[model samples]
Target chain A: MAKVPVQFTLNGSEKAEFIDSGTTLLHALRDKIGDTSPKGGCHQGTCGACSVIVDGELRLSCLTLAETCNGATITTTSGLAEGGVLHPLQRAFLDTFATQCGFCTPGMIMAAKVLLDHTPNPSREDVVEALSGNICRCTGYEPIIQAVLTAARGNSQNAA
Target chain B: MAIRRGRGVAAINYPTGMNLGGDPTQALVHSTPTGNFMVTLSSVDLGQGMKQIMAQICAETIGVPTDCVVVDTADTDTGPHCMGTFASRGTHRAGNAVIQAAKEARQVMLEVAAEELEVNASDLETDGQGNILVKGAPQKSISIFDVALSAHFKRGRSISGRGMFLIPRSYPEKETGAMKPSTCYAHACTVAEVEVDDETGEVTVLTVKNVFEIGRALNPKMVEQQLVGGSWMGISHALYETTEPYYPNRDHGGTDFNQYLMPGPGDLAETEIIVLERPSADGPYGAKGPGEMCANPQIPAVANAVFDAVGVRVDTLPITPERILRALKAQAN
Candidate 1:
């Protein structure tokens, strides 16, 4: 397989990289770009742990190929925080005790963040639908729902 | 507090004896000769909030804030040996260790205070605020920290504490003919009302009401979260979640995140957690382990609820829609 040069914007910075033909976007971001926030749970699109926002749409980075993400702008879990402060969703998780093992946190947060980005005040149903792909063995969905609601309240407060 | 069954006991000694002690927070911190706080805890957190509960036990015993006392998990080299974190042993075992440690520290501090106040060690009283007060002399007082530092500086001896709480070794009560082998059991009864689709066999759990005897609840909010979260996992295991085989080959039929499903928002209805405050004689602050205990009963409770709803009993776990349909068909036939 021939290694191809790829250029893309990652976490608000433009990066040029070259990767083998079979390399996935997840590998490009994790190994080559030194960003490991988007975990490789199931290389298949079944697990949503590899979910990331590309051009305002949530997509599973594991399913996305390096070639397809050329010149694209990508935002991962590492990008969620700004200036050493956690995102509202992260804080909400801590306050609500949403995270246990912390393995599924990045993906679950990204999914919930994407849902809330579109629907600021999402109902429990909406939150479930958005996060249906992410699997967490520790917390049953109650705390996750509570964390989402807390983030929604924060979003409204910020808006006000 | 034995849980008596019909003319017999489920376990020989289901409900163990309860410990009674006055608010002895001052003696743990004020006394000297700090002992090793030994504990047995399972590595897994079943959501019972044992970590915080252990902290509370140490804090209350040693006259310190909850924030100051750090709860440790079961690692061989940490301090003392502990059982892995299961069966709700965190507070009782670890809390007792902390109590012992604090007691040792208190004894030494009291001795130093006795010398400073020119009074007999037995006559001096350790106040709740970690101060040693001379009887009938309100003006004569010394702080626990000062006494400890002074003992270390003047006597050139280290002021420390240690504690160890072993699970009571006992045989099943012979006359009772029961399996009561648990160190201390926390009892709980949960009622779940669920709705079933007669045609599709899909079950929507409407309400779950649980009343559990958890020796004591150190942090109510943390407890509630554990209950709610544990219940959710239990519900999923009962109705939705399953672990299929993992295959390296893509062609092989395997269970991954997509095929192996669990519960989401639409699957649940209302979840209610009721914590019973029956102080265990063995536990620190009287709290039982609540995390994994609730999880074991979820599948059976939901299955029972399904039976209540549509009159079908599921023998296997994860009473899926297909299994429900088959059972309903068999029942109809």
Candidate 2:
């Protein structure tokens, strides 16, 4: 297969890589760029472990082709920290003990980030609906939901 | 058809560790030159907080701060022997080994402090804040760091300890086949409420309330995490999960996550948990294994709840809607 050239902004930096026609964005980010925070729980989109933000929209990296995201901006869990400071969602997850095995943590954080970006203060049921796609076998969806709500409250408090 | 609501309860007594062939685990504790401790083991954590709990055990046994201990596990070449992590034996078996090892290392640590303070080893006590002091003497104290430095450079002593824990296997008698199979038993009970549709044969779990009596909770937060997550798995196993949906004839089997169904986040039930501490004689700090038993009682409780809701007994792995419908049809006939 002929390698296709792709360029995209990752974590606020420009990155260029060559990938095959059907190579997934997950493969490009992990294998090419060496950012391995997004876990591959399932190659299929059902698990939601490879979730990422593509141009401010939540997209499953496993299902999105790398070539299609040539000029788009992407954000992952690796980019959530800035200058030794963790994001509010990351801080909430840690304080709330929302992770167990942590295989699904990055995806869960990304999904929560998208939800909070859209809805600054989400109800409990809204959090559930937003995170319905992700599968966490360890936490039973309780602490993760709590973490998102906690982050939302913190964000509102900071805004206030 | 209307939805019928009913509740059911189940209680279970679970044995800690496997009794077959003498289940064993080992630990090695040693102090660094900086007074920090390292616990080496071949057991794996599997994200159950094994490393954290082991560090806590080592810290408590050695009378040191928890942050001073680092648990390095699953290194076959350098770490000690372990019988793997199963049978809910990690905490009960491996924890005891870590305690014994830490005790021996603590003995040497206190001895070093005793020599530094010009006091008998018996008269020395650890303050659990990185200091060893003469008993009842406020001023006669030395930091663990200085003691460790003295042991390494001045006295030329290597502070290390090794420990192993094994439950002696008992053979069954020839006549009655009776034998003591476990060192300790953990108990749990669960009450499950369900709403079943009489016509559609659909079952929805409303709530699951449970009480677990482990020997002791070394880490209460981790214990709660396990119980909550395990109950969710129990509810899934009761109604949702199955690789072989049509068993006995393996023509159709699930090959992926989609086919192998599990309860989604929306399918969760309201879970309430109450934990009781009844310390065991042989447990580490009276702590029993709560790994596998947290998921057991909910299985039976959900099954009994299904029976209560629709008045049908489905004794299958997963009480599927098709099975419930079949049982209802059989009852109608």
Top candidate on lDDT is 2
| Candidate 1: CAPRI quality band | acceptable
lDDT of 1 by residue, B1-333 (tens): 121111101111123322222111111222232222222233334445666666566556655455645454545454344554544444555566667766675566667778777788777775556567887886888776677667766765444466655554445578885643555676666677777787877777777766666667778877777777777787788876655322234453426765777665556658777777877666666666565666655566777778877777778767887887899899989
> Candidate 2, residue B322: CA error in Å?
0.6
Q: Which candidate comes out best when scored by DockQ?
A: 2
lDDT of 2 by residue, A59-144 (tens): 99999999999899999999999999999999999888889889999999999999999999999989999999999888888889
What's the CA error at residue B262 for candidate 2, in Å?
Answer: 1.2
Full-model lDDT for every candidate:
0.68, 0.92
lDDT by residue (B1-333, candidate 2, tens digit) is 889998999999999999888888899999999999999999899888999999999999999999999999957777799998888899999999999999899999888888888989999888999998888995889999999999999998777788899998989999999999998999999999999998888889999999999989999999998999889998988998888888887867888788888887788899999999999999999999998999889989998999999899989979888999999999999
Clashing pairs in 2: none
lDDT of 1 by residue, A41-104 (tens): 8899876778888877888889888888887888898997899999999999999988766777
Error at A92, model 2, angstroms: 1.2
Worst 10 residues of 2 chain B by lDDT: B248-257
